[model samples]
Target: MVVVNVYAPNIYTNRRRLWDKFLSLCNSIEGIWLIIGDFNEVRVPEDRWNSVFDNNNALHFNNFIGAAGLLEYPMLGRKYTFLSGDGKKLSKIDRALVCSDFMTKWPNTSLRALERNISDHSPLILSSGASNYGPTPFRFFNSWIEIPGMVEAVNRGLNKQGNENFKDLLLG
Candidate 1:
């Protein structure tokens, strides 16, 4: 797996150049890849609030994602990841993009935004879902008997097993 962190420039020409160069690099690579960081750009109008929107810049940014065959996962916990000092302007600029191979390998990939205490940008977290611990243990709640099929389902399930303790506890 390859991870490439990028801090894109605010200048249109410079960011475009960077995108072209990065596209070339991706073409030559042969493995799962994850690219993330402050892209200094947004993919849609909804990504910005109380700020000017540039359709051309968004087009270029999305073109870069398409040309690189990068997949952007849905962000969780927040709508915007950046805020101005005045707390008036907000934008969702930081993101995580993965190649198809990486998405295939880690289908449960997700992105979340953390609190932005001091910095202008919120910290972004990318993870591949939960870690496996073990099988779940069974526990019965008395309140569950209020449900329609609770008693019958329990009786059917209990009948399939030979655990006398469970049978006694359930019956009592």
Candidate 2:
């Protein structure tokens, strides 16, 4: 997994040169590749909010991803990964990108945005493992009792029999 934090310069010419070099380097590499971090640019207009969308920048960013054969991993738990100091402007400048080989190897891979506490960008957590640590904790919801068929559904789920042992259940 290759983690990159590209600092795209404000000047358009400089930005193109930097991205070109980066893409060339990535293209030369072999095997599964996963890139993640702040790109300083967005691939689409939807990626930004409360700000003027730059069509040219978006086009360039999308072109870079296509040239590198990298697929942006879908983010979970949030729409925007970045927050301005005033908590007004929002954008998804940080993301995870993986090549096709990497995706094939870890088909269940997922990226989640953790709470943004220290910085403007939210920290991302990526995991491929699907292991279950333990039995899911049961929570009693007072509203559930008022719902129709809730009792029957709960009883059915609780009484369901399975041949798997405790070890299998624990491991999921």
Candidate 3:
């Protein structure tokens, strides 16, 4: 089983480009796929927690998703995930979507809204494939180095260790 994540930027007003890229990506992938991120688009006026704003922009995005054959993952928390800084325009900007293939491959894919960490947009967690193992901490260390060399180092370490445990922890 393979997991693919797609994070598209907010296309609040550009539906053509968004739809075109979505179509190209859907046709290109072969296995189970999941597209999860802040689309900045809405499927319907009801999708927004507050419906008093200009929603012409959102309807266009909804059409794009429908035409692309992608289904929205019904939100579990408060419908609104993003709010304009001024506290006037509220919208469901962050969301996750999946194709039928993903359902067949990993039916348990669940997305939840995490606390907003870096950006105003909430973090979307898309757990596609099942894992008996639970959540693992993600580490980020900035080291100025060559990208290809990092790959080579990882490959060499894997080959030498052959799935041995604690190598990463020990090295760190």
Candidate 4:
């Protein structure tokens, strides 16, 4: 079985090329195609936190995903995957798509959204081995706020921030 977790950053600007690439890349792969990752696109208005904004890219993304004949795993509970840093906007950009053949063969496969920690984006976890499961509890730590320059770093940009070695921070 082929399990995939792809992150397509800036998908809004490269919809055409990205969709073409996705099709070409998946065409060669065999077995189960479980594509899970942040797509940065919403299938509908209900999928986005800010529907008033013109999101032509999101519409284009939906068309491409439908043409690929993939199954969009129905999201349970939490409707949005991203939150605006200021709490004004939210959207469901993260998703899991599986091919019909894969679903038929592995009926047990499931996907769900995980909680956010340091970043505005929520983590998505997919499990093909489990037959059934429910949402997992997320733990929060106030200590994270005590980290030096943590707030400043977040303001600068979460992705561009210098390596903080989170594992080391926790273990030290």
In terms of lDDT, the best-performing candidate is 1
Query: How high a TM-score does candidate 2 get?
Result: 0.71
User: What is the C-alpha lDDT profile of model 2 across 1-172, one tens digit per residue?
Assistant: 5656554675767777777987897888666777777777888889999987989988887898899888977899888988988989999988888889888888898999988889888888889969887776546789988999878777666566776543324221
Evaluation by lDDT, superior candidate among 3 and 4? 4
Error of 3 at 166 (Å): 23
Per-model root-mean-square deviation over C-alphas: 6.9, 8.7, 12.3, 17.1
Q: Candidate 4: which pairs clash?
A: 49-90
> Candidate 3 on 57-168: residue-level lDDT in tens?
7666666667657776666655577777766666776787677876776677777776655766777766665666743654645562455477666656555643546455
lDDT string, candidate 1, 101-162, tens digits: 88898899889988898799989999889998854557768899999988987787667656
Reference-based TM-score of each model: 0.76, 0.71, 0.60, 0.65
TM-score of decoy 4: 0.65
Which residue pairs collide in model 3, if any? none
Report the CA-based lDDT of candidate 3 relative to the real structure: 0.63
- lDDT per residue as tens, model 4, 44-151: 778766556446776677677777777877766467888888888998888888889877886776667777787898877666664435444434478877999776
| lDDT per model vs. reference | 0.88, 0.80, 0.63, 0.71
Model 4: residues with Cα > 4 Å off, grouped in runs:
51-55, 129-172
> Could you give the candidate ranking by lDDT, starting with the highest?
1, 2, 4, 3
